[model samples]
Target: MTSTDELLVKEITVSRQSSGEERRLALHQIYVQVLERQPYAFERKQLAKIEADFLRNKIGVKRFLRELGHSEVYLNAFYYNSSNPKFIELCFKHFIGRAPSDQAEMRRYCDILMRQGVRDMITALLDSEDYSRHFGCFTVPHAWAEASYPSPRTFWETEVLLHELHGRRGWIVPTMVWHDLQLNCDGGSCRLPEPSLSSAPSSRTAAVISGSEALHQVLSTMGPQDLAAFAATLSTAERDKLRHLLMQSVQ
Candidate 1:
């Protein structure tokens, strides 16, 4: 028998294994092995069959994506410019379901995307007007949103203002949450009142606010002892934001 026939025979043996989950896992391995070992044999018809098998048998799209993530051929097939949107939609649906496997795979994929600066791919997928129609439903994770756009200030500026206004405690708004708030605002027209011009603060106030331009004013006005005192009272989230702002100012 030919190699293709031999592979089919091996697949049959694995499929007949006692455990259903093991059998399914084996089938996925066999499919990946066939693609890797004899890629030239994968004509359009065979590829279609492979995809169907993956959809029917693979319990977790995240696990499948993780397996496929290890294969450059697979990644290129799904994510390259001419990648198939139908297959991507299938993967997205599988991922959205609560799967520990999905979370691990997503973390891996996000890391890869971040390192490659391929945020455009994710944004394009999310921004597609037909995304909901194609995927059924979609809700982006806050981390994904933040990674796609790094400018926390732009996205969360209004949220920050609101937090300041309300005297909310221990909340450092994420950049993506900020972005969503801004996008949802009226005509991109939301403004925070100048902190200096606002009513006088109580002695117990733990935070101060200033316009983006007045950040320098706040820093220049503080002595070393006051800066240390202020830093001591800030939450971790607030401290991180302050560090980010300091880095931006220096740059």
Candidate 2:
């Protein structure tokens, strides 16, 4: 195995001795320590490997939730359905109140969170009556994490925000397209065509439309014909609105 793989094995072996809750906390601490020490060396694939191994062996789903509840990781609190709701809440409160640096670590946490059932809970929190009044005052770690992962539910929340806050203003074209076509596609693996700003308005619009349409086509090819049909049913105005929003989403 590679050195990275060996390190992951070592981490898991050390983590195996802890109780379920302790194991979860230990894993998070390991991630934090690794990132602190290596900085750029720890990338997404390594993190994913660690999580897959954790899920496969050291902790079953229930135990994972239990650990999340007991750990100091506050995101666990937002992930309310876990085994230890009260403790998770406390951790969330502590993290929110104390560690500003935790935000940068969100992308790492997001991978694991996306696998757990916490995504919906976080989404509910974001959509709650309290979110707007408090979100601005709160620190959301990284914009990319807030925009990308943690769960399918969180992704939907991001989509809602894109439509409501960004879309309404007509500034929501390329960025939205980028998210829909690229960033949100398979953990940012989707390749996008280059934008051609030098083209005339008609050509540019056509190009954008083609790229936008390709996103749906790709999704359709992924076995969700119903969604593709639903996408097709969008009215001209609705399509225009979405296109405007998505186009703004590109980088």
Please name the candidate that would achieve the greatest TM-score relative to the true structure: 2
Cα lDDT tens digits, model 2, 126-156, are: 3434323333222221122332244553344
State each model's CA lDDT, in order.
Answer: 0.33, 0.35
Candidate 1: tens digits of C-alpha lDDT, residues 105-197: 334433434455343334433433433332322121111222222244422332232222211221122212223222122222222222354
Query: What stretches of model 2 exceed 4 Å from their correct place?
Result: 1-14, 19-21, 24-203, 206-210, 222-225, 239-251
Among residues 3 or more apart in sequence or in different chains, the pairs in candidate 1 whose N, CA or C atoms overlap within 3 Å are 155-178, 155-179, 156-178
All candidates: TM-score: 0.22, 0.24
Candidate 1, lDDT over the whole model: 0.33
Prediction 2 global C-alpha lDDT? 0.35
- Deviating ranges (above 4 Å) for candidate 1: 1-54, 64-114, 119-190, 194-199, 202-206, 209-251
